[model samples]
Target: MPEYDEQDPVDISRPNPARMYDYYLGGAHNFAVDREAADRVLAILPETREFAMRNREFLQRVVRFLAVEAGITQFLDLGSGIPTAGNVHEVVQAVHPDNRVVYVDHEPVAVAQSQRLLADNPYTAVVHADIRDHETVLNHPETRRLLDFSQPLAVLMLQVLPFIPDTDDPAGVVATYRDMCVSGSYLAVAHSLSFDYWPGAVAEAVEMYTKSTHPLNLRTPDQVAAFFDGYDLVDPGVVFTAVWRPDKPVSDEEAISSRAVAGLGVLP
Candidate 1:
């Protein structure tokens, strides 16, 4: 929990996965409620924090590969949480200074942070919109301003899809975004893994998170792979986030606890 002044709104009262994630990234935007809730679930699953760190590294490596290897200059990051260390824009723009990026998140805090950080940068913009609203997200004025849909852009859905359960048409939601992208566009995905390592811990964590403003919906490797249905996955496909493209050799203990699976795919 962070010490807050009266300016802090009640949005901090309820637990939010985004703010919790920001907390994991060692960012200062989260509240005591979010921290306490994250601490509760993490106490049950101690690996959660390690897994989050690996997931963030995966995002950074994947963005570098997409920008340098795939020659992508535009990026659309959905479910983008707080603007913290090594954000998508930072990584991508480092490789290509003119890279255009649009960060989208439904959280008010995330939106406010992005808007503040990106205010004067015409090459980058953040919009407060749900990724599920494919049309609205694609046609957003900010989206149109910062992205050229006709050109190849890297679309990142890291740790976002699980929130929209299959019953709500998660597959269709993915396809809608894929359909909008041009051939050779890239897709990056990362999500929580559902495995047998910690049944009680996982259930308790999910139960706690599901009660939050943003829901949790962990998925199997198959379900995670399915999200790449129509795309060509890059090398070392669909592995745990730590194993995706490790900046350096990751220890066994580090990899084992990194429960999330993340990968990059290219639309052919």
Candidate 2:
């Protein structure tokens, strides 16, 4: 891990969604402010941690499928949070050492930690940029070096779109990235479900996030599916995060308890 000094640009006073997510994943990269905010969300919804874990599991499963089954060698992970276990490069490189990956994030901690972790791996790199800025992320030297737009690569947006409010045109953002790739390129998305789908403290939890660096913008299933407009969804299209091609059997209760929806699509 990279050392964070006083001169670092990270603001420990405010809660960051990436750090809060790291806290939920039991990662040590988060600060007290993030923990307090995450704890508040956990108090409101005890299953928040479970949701985070499920989202990570979903990411691993999807990336593994893309690398091994779909035969994709390049990956562009947008809004990738603090590097945790089973990251995209780890999962893909296990299949083929040369598998390339570019991780994009605006969080200083996430970018720094990723840069440190990926220093020795020439096949991977970290781009410190906001995912919504498709031009910046796509044009970054690392992204251009590691990912080829003409080839079939997987673009991952797990648990990312919620941070992009509708006012920013999140669907258009996806479309922008999608248009840059070839027909066989893939798009994987996992987003928190709207309060209507998950009644109870979900609204309150979202309200709590409003105070954080990235405010949560939960969307309906239809709204989430709109991101895959130009692509054909894979089997079991747009289902609960835990139920999307789970490596292990998922109980009905576990599926219902999942607070988010996930799906993988291929440009047809």
Candidate 3:
């Protein structure tokens, strides 16, 4: 486990979305503040844990599909939170040992933990930078060294765009990244949906995130699909995360309960 001291650039006094996500995934990297905040969210939405798990499962499934079906060997995972089981590297590496993965995040604790976890893997690296900074992330020495822009790769934005508001032009940022990739490259995105299933509870849960280091910005399905403007969406297009190429049968209730949508697009 990675240890943090006062010298580390981490603020434990406030709730961090990365730490809260770790808490949701039942990881031990979170602190009391994070747990408390996550508990409040759980109180508002009892299925918060299930949502996190489903998001993770979606990430793993998509990466595996990119590696196996799409013939992709390189991955750039933006806003990758604290390292946990079934990471991008682990999922893709399983398809082929030489597959490379670069994880990018601005969270100090997440970067520290990822660095520690990937220390022994030559095919994987962690970049301590925000996803919105295309120059920094694309120009980082580790990223350039591990990933070749000339070849096809997959850019993963799983459950992270919710932190980016419209003022930042999240769609434009995605377009910038899309322009950086070559033809045949892929982009996979998963974003929280603003649905009316549980309006009161969901609104409260979204509000709770405003107090965290990263606030949530729920988007409609069409808004989420807009992120893939320059690419062709794979079969099923943007749909509930649970039904996006799920490994097993998913009932209508289960799909509706996902509370988020995901899709993979390929540059044509």
Candidate 4:
């Protein structure tokens, strides 16, 4: 096992995206700075917290759908934040205990939390790696041990793409994972959408979060769907977070993300 120590924290003085997101989800792993920043973002866009919850629901729905219907037992959750509420392993393992899950994140706190939460559970683990390093993530020790590349796996990029700038090849990051797993593999992804929902809502939210460690990169619907080029998108293709195979009927409140979008794609 590689020594999972602290990395280059360019500026730990300000709020971090992962930590701010954790704060939005009501998780305890965040700092006061993160909470303050999240509060500011919420002030700019009241729907920020609402979108987070809906995204969580979306993650659970997709995990269960893959585990039960797709018969996928391997899951690689990229940019997975602090474990809270309904997690991938909790949801999938409930359906099939043997299901294996590996969460990858560059956030130190997130990696630590993932380790603590999954220590006794051999089937699930977390690795510290950047989303841009697709090759390293694919070959990570925890990931290699828990996931079988030859079998069908779910590549989860939930609400993670926006963290990486288009200059870093965000689409390429997803396509790399898509091409690695075997033909029956699946992909579940969601990205912060552009300002289509509320004229200037997206841009305003981005401006609010600029104080955080990373700058946000919200994408348009067309740009978001392009991430699924190699695979066949499942029904209700590339729709808003609540619209993708929603577990329960989506209320007007849940469907608010005519702004953010999500979908699942199957390889074959």
Measured with C-alpha atoms, the lDDT of residue 223 in candidate 2 is 86
TM for candidate 3 is 0.98
Model 3 spans with C-alpha error above 4 angstroms: 195-200
Q: Top lDDT: which candidate number?
A: 3
> Clashes per prediction?
1, 0, 0, 0
From the highest TM-score down, the ranking of the candidates is 3, 2, 1, 4
Write candidate 4's Cα lDDT for 1-268 as tens digits: 1233465343458888988887778788877778888887788887788788878888988999999998998899999988897899999999989899999998888888789889899999998999888778878888788888887888999988988887888888887888798898898888888766754455767886677778888888889899998899899999988888776687776676545899999987
Model 4 residue 6 CA deviation in Å? 9.1
C-alpha root-mean-square deviation, candidate 1? 2.2
Off by over 4 Å in 4: 1-11, 199-202, 251-253
* lDDT of candidate 2 at residue 187, scale 0 to 100: 99
Question: Candidate 2 lDDT, tens digit per residue, 166-237?
Answer: 899998889999999998999999999888767567888889888988899988888888899999999999
TM-score against truth, every candidate: 0.93, 0.97, 0.98, 0.93
Order of the predicted models by lDDT, top scorer first: 3, 2, 1, 4
RMSD for each of the candidates? 2.2, 1.3, 1.2, 3.2
Off by over 4 Å in 2: none
> What is the lDDT, from 0 to 100, of the residue 106 in candidate 4?
88
Local distance difference test, each candidate: 0.85, 0.91, 0.92, 0.83
